[model samples]
Target: MKKIGKTLKSACVLGLSGALLVCSVGCSSSSESSGGEKTGKKQLVFWDKSEYVTAYNDMMKEKVDEFAEKYDVDVDYVIVNSGDLEQKLAAAIESGNQPDIIMGDNTSVAEYIASDQLAEVSDVLADIDLKEEAKPYAVFNDTEYLVPLSLTAPGMFARQDVWEEHGLEAPKTWEELKEQAKIINDPDNGFYALGLPLGESGGGDAETFIRTIILDYGGEVVNAEGEVTVNSPEVLEAFKFIASLYEEGLVPPDATTWDDSGNNSAYTAGTVGVVFNSGSLMGTLKDEYPEIWDNTAIFDYPAAEEGGQSYTLGGANVFGIFKTGDNTETAKEFISYFFSDTDFYNEMVEAIGGMWQPVINGYDDTEFWQDPDNAVWLTAASNLTLTTAPAPTTDTAAQGFSNHLCTKALQNIVVNGMDPQEALDGLEADLNELYQ
Candidate 1:
């Protein structure tokens, strides 16, 4: 298993002076004015992974500037590459400095919750509305600390022309998807039905897709005892389905080692006819290759097996205030501001090219989604509940990285003739041991 905290260990090791620490937190204030008045604007420092960094450039900076002007508080955005965020946060937490607010993986939120770093929403966020899609992340010990932003997962996409020419409609069931995939797997036509990347990309996609299928087979990642349920007949069914997909030649040969961007490349190169993809991903295809973007069509994941939920695993970005500094109040205010700030939210959507519903209730219906631009993504997140975790057992299973592991397990099953049941069963055992 890949160790998570080894690199972060050095950065987070305590005993270092505050001046020597690298910060992952933004703005917060826990101190009452001691003997003097506070001066200057309250600067809230924030950290997010790299994709959001590009988004901040996409008018997010301007939106913060606008929020600063409107609320009279300076919002400082700290951009960190997504891969390095955990290490940075670990380091910061070690030295008594953490971001005022952090937005990263949905699964990762459990780690923050386990630490003393987070502030319970309590009455502070009581007024903020939440979507059905986001509330599952907050149900820890019957309390919540996160305000969800983006709800994302892969969906099916196709070249409209190919579907029209072949007279194939969107597949709603696994059987149909396989049948359609077989028809489109013709190498002579320069088209493949799916983008095969068995590395991390394939791994994650495979896990979620299979998990949904497992659910179809009456399987779940955990059992009634709150332990793993991966080694069951249901999971075996899920494995059997994936193995069938590979053995039947529905997936491309290079899927086992395809790089990060390989799937999208296949779509852009017009080498694929159908795929499981997302609307947020479309922006790249559009900007880099508008023609491919035009040919692209986004849909939800097809049923990999009969009786499956039209589902994808639950995933979202959660923001939290760290347990550092005297800036706790400032941190809470920023969370409230970030969640409720109308202008900031809009700019966030505009910059990131992804939509994050505002935290306040009913805010999702706030004309923003209805805009022509948001139509596609809004749909992607709409029916996502079918794939979400049952309450009381959400992030605890993965400790914030289950999706990552599941994805990897999927990759193992996709190529190499690995058994899905054995792969998931092993993954379940390891994951259970981590938190056991």
Candidate 2:
């Protein structure tokens, strides 16, 4: 865990594009051709919005060169900011000059699939065994379209020192979590029980928390048949639970407007005893806050009820081929190579740190994740589950996720004093329109 200067702060800016940045490196060219007919060579244009640290980019560039040499194809790779990815890719599509392959967030992948802009990569699916966390984003309309590269999830993490001082163990249920929070909360001294990001600005983090709670409470945005189910008792339960946290002053007072990084920033700044977050926070603690790192321990999301199950909300970075591009085969080949090259893939995964988790099945069994130093991150990743995983109930779930619909409903209840059922009613109406 090398100390990068405020890694999450930089990522907060980059992720404003609606997805966390990963390791995206590419070669650049001015060729406007979408076909594999660039001067008698198999030419492929690839777009990546995972602009991270220079080391990540450099590693990617090395892989690209190796790929070009092995495949005998010319690749035009460009790094684009995720915030601008949608507009840039849409503009290219409109101008009839789109990239052959794109690596992006699940939200964008779903949109491309919905719009029929992506080519099916059944061949790639045939070769790689995707983990359960990767499956939801990999398919569209029962056809494999996305090649998932990595996984991420938000889970409960606590300061072990704080817990030990209070003679407490890591909580395993929501009731226990609340009890523990009460013991640790010290708002006047700038210490909070939990770092819950109830903010509405950063779509992914806020929605991840809301959705996980809804799922555990047996609520879902839609059912298997694509009908809206956002107004269920389970949804109200989840909403009420979140509101209790705010009204009780367990979380920060300014949490209502904080971005996704709010909780991470709070936790890193030593203001929170526990937090539900991705591995990035752990990475920061390991590097910049060594004392905190020594005291940090991660656990699965607390169960919604006694003896009931809970899950971390999973998201992915995926590579998808565009139907508009001419070198679909070449694009697939590149992705296939990336997944098959285990040594390089493992190195890349380690280099990127907690920003990503392996989507491939066996990667977790490896030393990189198995090492004690990576315990917090590995625990978080191991508990990963998609908001709409096992199967998506609605085609619009991805769109709803990007729009932060559930998050807003939460804000309505907690910040505006709206009745839980009333909030659900509005959410249900909007979801009906989306799923219909």
Candidates' C-alpha lDDT: 0.62, 0.77
Which window of ten consecutive residues has the lowest lDDT sum in model 1? 26-35
Q: Can you give the TM-score per candidate against the true fold?
A: 0.78, 0.86
Cα deviation of 256, candidate 2, in Å: 1.4
Over 4 Å off, model 2: 1-38, 51-54, 375-383, 389-394
Name the top lDDT candidate.
Answer: 2
> lDDT by residue for model 1 over 381-417, one digit each (tens)?
6656423354244446545244456556666676555
* Predicted candidate 2 versus true structure: per-residue lDDT over 18-135, tens digit per residue: 4422322211233334344566778888887654544556777787888898878888888888778888988998988889988887767668777788888888888887777567
Q: What C-alpha lDDT, on a 0 to 100 scale, does residue 423 get in candidate 2?
A: 90
lDDT of 1: 0.62
Candidate 2: worst-modelled 10 consecutive residues by lDDT: 20-29
